[model samples]
Target: MSTKLELPIQEFTTPYPVTAREDSSIEELLDIVKNLKVRHIPIMSNGKITGIVSDRDLRIVSALSAREKFLVRADDLMTSDPVTFQGNTSIEDVILEMSEKKIGSVLVADEKGDLQGIFTVTDALDVLIEILRGRK
Candidate 1:
């Protein structure tokens, strides 16, 4: 049987993931997260990825009063310069980096460094489940 780990990460990546601008308001971010059922959103500027924001980050700022929340933007809560890997990178390599860095997700870019997708912890779990099932 072919081990899935040898495959390129792009094979399992969620391509063209939903993205946000640094200037996006908390309300807008919340709407995207709630409506789309996504846990992370890459922050893009001029078609380039600048940072990333997660639901956990949002929760931290959600405790603010209504007016305070309105004043917050995605950049305020985003982790700037998130780790990224080429789409053709091996799945094992990406997963290793994620585990070592304790990061929930990593951005996938193309040869030109254009954002292609996102691979999150949930995605890894799903892949694990698939591999386990195949073992039966």
Candidate 2:
């Protein structure tokens, strides 16, 4: 029973994820998270990915005063230059990299460096659950 995880990540990636602009307000970010029920929002500048903000990141600043939150923007609190991988990248490699970096998600881009999608730890878990079920 070979359990090799060598498949391309595109099959499991969440394609065309919702994104935010660098200058988007913290409130806008929060709205996106709440309304869309998504955990991560890639920050874009000039149509290119610049950073990422996760639900955890937002929660960290949730304690800030209302005025302070209003003054904040996506770029102000996002993780800059988040780890990225091509959609064709192997699942094992992507998972290993995410584990090494201790990150919840990684952006997937095309060869032209355009944002393609996002693969999160939750996605990985889903993949694992599928594999385990197949083994049963």
Candidate 3:
């Protein structure tokens, strides 16, 4: 019997990788988040993932004044060098990393180091339940 994780990270990931430019306004990114129902948006600059903005990061802007909010950009508040995982990575490995890091999610990138998808704790838990029930 193979003990390898049957479920791949990509299987449970959110793809098309919504992203924001480093120079983009917080309002723009906020709008993206609202309209797309995305919790995290990767900050892309020069075709690279420079940072990442999470729902929590956006809330910090909401806590500020309307005028002050304009002063903020995705780059200003996003987490730099966030934990990232590969598309082929196993769910078990990702779950372990997320648990150890106490993070809710991690960016999923492809073989060429391009942003591919996102894997969240919620996604992992859902997979866990399915696997336990022999439904995967």
Candidate 4:
């Protein structure tokens, strides 16, 4: 019997993920983050991705600019030029990349840079759990 390990990220990624505009207010992104229970949100502008916002970004902004909450926007705190990968990339590479970069998630885009989905640490954990179960 053989066990497969080199699975493509598309097999487990969260496709068509929720996104937000770079101009969105911190309060709005916070609401979305809480309601969706998702940490990373791809930030877009003019139908083009500009950055990614995360819970950490929001927390930093909120804590640093407590008096200027109204002045903070996604663009002000987003991680510009976030790491991205194609769906065909292997799961091992995904985890390796994230581990090397110390990031929790990466955007999934096609050759044309079209937004497809997101692959996060949670997804990686799920894959790990599946592998462990299969080994049992």
**Against the true structure, what is each candidate's TM-score?**
0.92, 0.93, 0.89, 0.90
lDDT of 4 by residue, 8-122 (tens): 8888899988999988988999998999999999998887678999898887776756559888888988999999999999888899889999999999988878889999999
Each candidate: how many clashes?
Answer: 0, 0, 0, 0
| Quality of model 2 by C-alpha lDDT | 0.93
Give the per-residue lDDT digits (tens) of candidate 3, residues 18-81: 8889988988988998998988888888887788888888887788987888788777998998
Better of 1 and 4 by lDDT: 1
TM-score of 3: 0.89
**Where does candidate 1 stray beyond 4 Å?**
1-4
Candidates 2 and 3 compared: the better one by lDDT is 2
Runs in model 2 lying further than 4 Å from the true structure: 1-4
Which whole-number lDDT from 0 to 100 does residue 41 have in model 4?
Answer: 96
lDDT digits (tens) for residues 1-136 of candidate 2: 9575888888899999999999999899999999999999999999999999999999999999999999899999999999999999999899989999899999999999999999999999988888789841
| 1 against 2, candidate with superior lDDT | 2
Runs in model 3 with CA error above 4 Å? Answer: 1-6
Q: What does the lDDT read for residue 45 in candidate 3?
A: 88
Local lDDT at 21 for model 2: 99
Segments of candidate 4 deviating more than 4 angstroms: 1-4, 64-67
* TM-score, predicted candidate 2 vs. hidden true structure: 0.93
Better candidate by lDDT, 1 or 3: 1
Model 1: per-residue Cα lDDT over 84-127, one tens digit each: 99988988899989999999999999988799999999888877
